[model samples]
Target: MSASSSRPSYAAVLRLSHARRTFGAALLGRLSYGTVSLAMMLAVNRATGSYVVAGTVMALFGVMSVLLSPARAALVDRYGPRRALGPMAMSYASLLAVLAAVSWRPGAPVALVAGAAVAAGACTPPLGPTMRAVWGEVVRDKALLQRAYGLDGVAEEVLFVSGPLVVGGLLRFAPPAAGVALSAVLVASGTLAFVSSPVVRGVRPTPAVKSARRPRGGRALLQPVVVAGGVGLSLGAVDLLVVAFAEQRHHGDDVVAWVLAALSAGSALGGLLNGAFEWRTNARVRLPLLAAGLGLALAAAGLAPGLLALTVAVACAGLFVAPALTTAYLIADESAPPGFRTQAGAWVNTAVNAGGSAGAATVGLLVTHAPLGLCFALAGTVALLAAAVPAGSRMPTPTTA
Candidate 1:
């Protein structure tokens, strides 16, 4: 066959275009969310005169997001990306504005802040799952999708690392209100850009089959969908542990940036490698290896006696990060019913976030009572345990319904 004949057909071109648009939307959504999160932390901290209070507010935001994320995902599955993305973006912006106003007032009521946090959480755009579903539609090749995920992972790391620094600087040099206003601007700019994209504009919700009914009990938990959620939770916990370890070691301020950078860098490398491979491996092999590697790295980091050793160890831990996550993504994709693809993706994200929250809470307590090394060891052990979960169970069957 001629090279041209082997090349992606005209259909592939259209798909690529759609993928590009979806990626743009995802990037913008992440940027906006990151900015708001950073600014909110600073604003709350300044207003309450306590980091603990600020953290509580942040925790509330997480809880709200986790609780509502499934519903938002369902909305996307039911109503399509356009309908879900636009309204959620607007709501998020409005919430941020309200939060800013509340912060601007001296001694603003705690109840008011708490209420806004809940609202903000509930309004979070279902970007991760929605974008994943969009990508699935646009990218016909599995390898290409993996690359896209790697890029997405990198973008998230950049956003989180940079967002806080920007907010911190604004809070220090400009008024606290300035940071809040800047956050609002970021959200509006990013979210609006995403909603207006042609790809998003063209998306239509798939029609649900009228004969389909939800699956029953224990069988449901064993489904690939549930397993994917579990994987997400594990990943989230790893993230939280990283932060907690940094804080305990007096490296909290800069360590987050470094650790995330390392992980993103590793994931980017993995993506490139994934694209090069023409063959596939079983999750059975991939998950355990990645998890074991990560576990060892974290344990090594905990045992490190100096900053240099700690940095090296963390970077090593990051080496397996992408492969493990990609495995979870693939599992979820293969397992979900067509209409629930978006929701499945969101569930994975929610699990990760919830797991991270739990890890943070656990490490916070451990740091106070135990050695920092122990905290790191605990994270590694949990990751190792996560590796075992998939091994003991039968591989999830692909959904046909």
Candidate 2:
């Protein structure tokens, strides 16, 4: 495929008025949450002059967020985004203020900052799932939802990359207090804007959970959400591979950032192009093919003879990343019984997080003994499995109807 052959058409997706406002607010406001871990670490390390304390504090915050997300998402599923997320965002914003104020002091109390982080993480609105749910309500069209999810996948990638960069910049030029404060403002403001958007408020839960049906309750191996997360597991190895490759080659920090950024940039573009097309293919069929593509591309990345080859390979692999994720959401949302969409979304998030964490650990250990290509090979192999996971399994046509 030529370079110019894949440009995405963003017109149709962005044409919807409701999606425009909600997506814009959510994406912009999300930067604070996205950047918080790094910014908080930078703040604490700068203020207390200790990386140990900084790491510990952020670790508590992250672990709690990952652990608490499901329950919070369940709540949103139960009460709806407006009632659940609005209050949660406000309280989160308040706590962030306190955290920022306290962390700025000469010797901030460890317990207090930790407590604030815990509170914020536990109450943090499950917006990732919420947004997908909202898109269904506002767009009310299957094709558009695919586009929405595609845009969403791109936003997620961008958030992860830009969040750290934003914090890094603040740490270099601005005070840690400023970064924390800005994050608080962003969180509060974003939540309010998103929750208040007509699209989000209009979201209605699928009928009751009692009426909803799925294979093996929500934990089935063949479930779309589960398979999607397996993709996350495979892709997680991509980052570790990039870092390891950069280090093995003795590239500097700039190259490290650029290499990682390449994956995200590629994913962003792929998502755009993927969403642009209205495919005739079934979701189940598409899922595995995309996963296979991702796996093979990543494998090629590992085998690249040089930096240029690796860049092209990584970019090629990224082309499938967001589409795979969007398809997972499509399947999961379809598979979710009436009224359980939010919980299903949370589960997807959980599976991805858990899988990614585990893959990173495994890759890190193996990198010490194996060639970098071996890591890529492992990722590709797992991705192939992820593809097979839903191939013959019980699956309905992915649809909101």
Candidate 3:
């Protein structure tokens, strides 16, 4: 592949035919993912009057969502997104509506609520994976693809940060169930719009095309999956650890939210800046260094003497988060067998969610028993070890399907 005469701007990525319309619709659908968890948790807690039951229900939802993701994406790989995504979005939306109705009033049956949640999770659309697949299909230039991925990553960061706030605003005049219903509308409508795009409809399934110079089999995915898991693990630990730190210092719980917001701000900035440059090294070489940088920043966050210092340290850690995840996605895209790009991306998604769940559970238990600094160190060590995982050899000739 030959380099372009000049760097491709992110605006150029959007200027591609149908890029804005397709990407906008996909983001609208993906925002449902950002909002659903908080809405469902709140609805479940209100109905059950027991935090334990709510937590258990959420755990079941999350587990099903994470475990079935690759299978859902495989459907997209096998049948093309136009055929595969519509049914998934509709089914997921219907189930969410059912969940909202069941939890609208107190004394809802626990079995019914739990069953509805599980069903909804199983049907959740593979919009994120499908969108990345679309990006790969529409954007031929590697540099422009990098910008597209970076833009996507930064927008996702903003969505997650704003999602809970959206729920909070809804609670002012409506029940949490209303938020759930709104999520259903967002996915169904957005997906309907997404599949209607001419570019999206043109993405047909293709058989795997082998390249001898590229690494074969699932082994190629090992580094990105492991490193993504490490990033997720450290991030999961950060929430609880930050709260604990705030409490220990006699600060209000609200401080935790502000600190986390700082982290997101840094991530958005990092992603934008990362996308704006052209690097001599490929993603395989850049990924491990990004992971190590995150690990070091997190480890140092533990030693901050004041809230301001801790926030700054966390923000620095945030600098690596989006770029690392973007690089992981790029690697996944490059490593995917010709027909399996959606599944390849989904595998990384699963690893991140599973690792986050494990990290939260493990750190929740350890935070009570260990020193704060030790807990932070332990969390950071997971990423450091993952960074040490050799990134494997560079592709002699990188190829995209």
The lDDT for every candidate, in the order shown, is: 0.64, 0.75, 0.87
lDDT per residue for candidate 3 within 293-359, as digits (tens), equals: 9999999998999999999999999999999999999898888767788888888888888888988
Instruction: Give candidate 3 regions above 4 Å deviation.
Output: 1-7, 209-215, 393-401
* TM-score between model 1 and native: 0.82
Candidate 1: regions farther than 4 A off: 1-15, 210-264, 271-279, 283-285, 391-401
User: TM-score for every candidate vs. truth?
Assistant: 0.82, 0.88, 0.95
In order of lDDT, best first, we have 3, 2, 1
Over 106-203, each residue of candidate 2 has an lDDT whose tens digit, in order, gives 58777777788778777777778888776655555667677778888888888888887787777777778667788888888888899888767677
Clash count list over all predictions: 1, 1, 0
Better of 1 and 2 by lDDT: 2
Q: What digit string (tens of lDDT, one per residue) describes model 1 on residues 1-401?
A: 01121233333332465455556657766766666777777778776677888889988887898878878887887788777767887787788788888887458777787788778888888776777676666555665565555556545656766777777777667757566667666656666776677766766776555332334211232333333333344445456556666665677566776776676566556644543444467654565666667777777787877666766777776666656665565556555565666776776677666766676666656666777777777777777766666433443322322
Error of 2 at 189 (Å): 0.6
lDDT at residue 113 of model 2 (Cα atoms): 76
Preferred candidate (lDDT higher): 1 or 3:
3
RMSD of each: 4.8, 5.2, 3.4
Q: Clash pairs of candidate 3?
A: none
Model 3 lDDT-worst window of ten: 392-401
Q: Candidate 1 — worst ten consecutive residues by lDDT sum?
A: 1-10
Q: List the residue pairs that clash in candidate 2.
A: 206-339
